[model samples]
Target: MSTPVEQAFRDHWGRVLAALIGFLGDFERAEEAAQEAFAIAAERWPRDGAPDHPAAWLLTTGRNRAINRIRRERALAAKLPLLEPPRPQADQPAIPDERLELIFTCCHPALAVEAQVALTLRTLGGLTTEQIARAFLVPEATMAQRLVRAKRKVKAAGIPFRVPEGETLRERLGGVLAVVYLIFNAGYSAPPAQGELAAEAIRLGRALAELLPAEAEAHGLLALMVLHDARHDARVREGELVLLADQDRSLWDAERLAEGRALLERALALGGRGPYVVQAAIAALHAQDPPDWPQLAALYGELARLTGSPVVELNRAIAVAEAEGPAAGLALADALPLERFHYLHATRGELLGRLGRDAEARDAYRRALALVHDDAERRLLERRLAALG
Candidate 1:
């Protein structure tokens, strides 16, 4: 249902913006110019037809817009030094994919981790402030302020707009990987055909793995995403959510699964035992004909110890329920400090239902329904609640 211009925007927004940033060396100005270019494209492309190379056209248009703006503000132009434009090369990509550099700049340790992830989503993932805000479950105004502060910090601290080298790369890599994974999670959680964020995240993961071929976590992250994404088609059916246990395995993408397994093998071969590697190993096990519940519970326990996150503990509880029993999982879940998290209640509901505690299960399901927002999830919870009667 999207116009050609809108489709082009979705495909090339990040690349065009990255090129503009590399040219103008200012995030605000680069964004302004990119918007201007897209605005122009929306108007003109509809009538005149899209250019042969949309990205190249957009980048050139944005660059010219920036130059024109500088010319108009003579005092500002005089006060600020600009890089000389690089000569055009025939062999160069239409719009150079400088997103890696942009992401590194956004994820610099100088900024807070939340800001780093938010800023990367904005600048390199082409996500709107509202989209990023919703992903983080924060108000739009709060997210706007956070983004403003992050950009200001980047400018004030003069974070270099280039990928780091040597020890610095190793130091910054964790933040970058985390940002990419969060982006993936946001996309993965969305309803089917809602956005290209998951594919975009996988693309970024591929870039990271290629950029750091020896970095086991990079490969692990890529493997993790691909493995999970392989089940995208089977995750939903007939406009309803599908649990992994009930999903049609025939719907899963074999190619992606194979690629994921190969990548996991590569990561393990490289001595990966980090959080991502552990998660990748878990995902691989999930793909098996019959999952190893005991081994899975053990791996989740290891992950819980490595991350010390309550959410990870919650996942471990579920695995324990499968490996041990519902009472065991309920015992662990009841002690967690995640009173406000709906998933905890949802998990309790499922485990309680399995144990034939109808009344308690209904209460937990209702509690989850109260907190849940997504239509697909809400419907699932409602069905489960009704089944108790």
Candidate 2:
């Protein structure tokens, strides 16, 4: 079992790094300094006992270490003249929370979407380059280069290390939320053996919601994550994927589901009708016994209109099937331009099987099996194909 101090380090690593970056105004330097501080903590905490406020201690230590390193490097000192050492003083006022600022900076529109997501996972989510690369199915060196380039652009282009306001915040908020969802999806879709990217994303979502409590979309995103992750325990069994309907409902986290419902209610009350809110509402419907599939289909239709996403439409088709019949769902799925999407084919296969078109269903399942990446999903498809005989 990990010690409390060790757990605190894992939880607050991003916060400490964000604070250091704000103080030092250099991404690489801040990360290095934060790492050094944690290294020191590893050595000293066992001897000195853990501090009452580990995050604050880590931030202060990281800042001091950064200042000293700058002092020692004459070239670095010349480059960063504004980073003069702080004078010893009595308890200073608390540093403002800079994690939001850091995330906004990472998700700047100037960066590509992939880079923005990768950088956010690294800087704000505290994921290593290798871990992020693995999550995205990219090579380690490629991810490392991507992070390097992102940081270089941030420095060279002088992206402001502060949160935007008004219209700017509105424009940038979408990218940040997209990146968070991407992180969650990565964790949600990965094999059971991988890390919990979903939990990390949910934690980040909670932080974003707390930081911008008035932002309905933030709450919506958090609700969506909480609702989806509540099913994490039920999503798989015996190392195989388990469809939602087939999952043992008892395995679902009741507290998380309740929390998600409360968040959805709060978001709706805030007059949020955005895509995330709509999706969360759909998830809320699913949590119900004898789900309101008509309402779910309607919400998905609204989401499809808001986002113009074929995936949402495909989901809507599934809802339509549940509300109407498999044939209606198959018709909707057939019209979609998702030939390469494995889930689309898998869904079609199920609908076809339900309609007793075994031959077509078997072919559809084969197509899905060919395109599917996850072994568990592929196995499910294979089983469906075999059932056709």
Most lDDT-accurate candidate: 2
TM-score of 2: 0.92
Model 1: what TM-score? 0.77
* Model 1, span 1-389: residue lDDT tens: 99988888877887789878888888998999999999999999989998878888888888888888887887565634665664563244456778778888988888998898788778776778998787677999999999999988888889999988898887788889988888788789886443466887897798789867899999999999999999998998998999888989999999999999999999999999999999999999898888898899899999999999999899889988988999999999999999888889999999999999999999999999889988999999898889889
Worst 10 residues of 2 by lDDT: 87-96
Best by TM-score: 2
lDDT of each: 0.87, 0.88
* Model 2 CA deviation exceeding 4 Å by range: 75-81, 84-93
- Which residue pairs overlap in candidate 2's backbone? none
**Clash totals for all models, in order?**
0, 0
Candidate 1 regions exceeding 4 Å error are: 1-16, 32-72, 75-82, 88-97, 109-118, 127-150, 165-168, 192-194, 327-331, 352-375
TM-scores, all candidates, are 0.77, 0.92
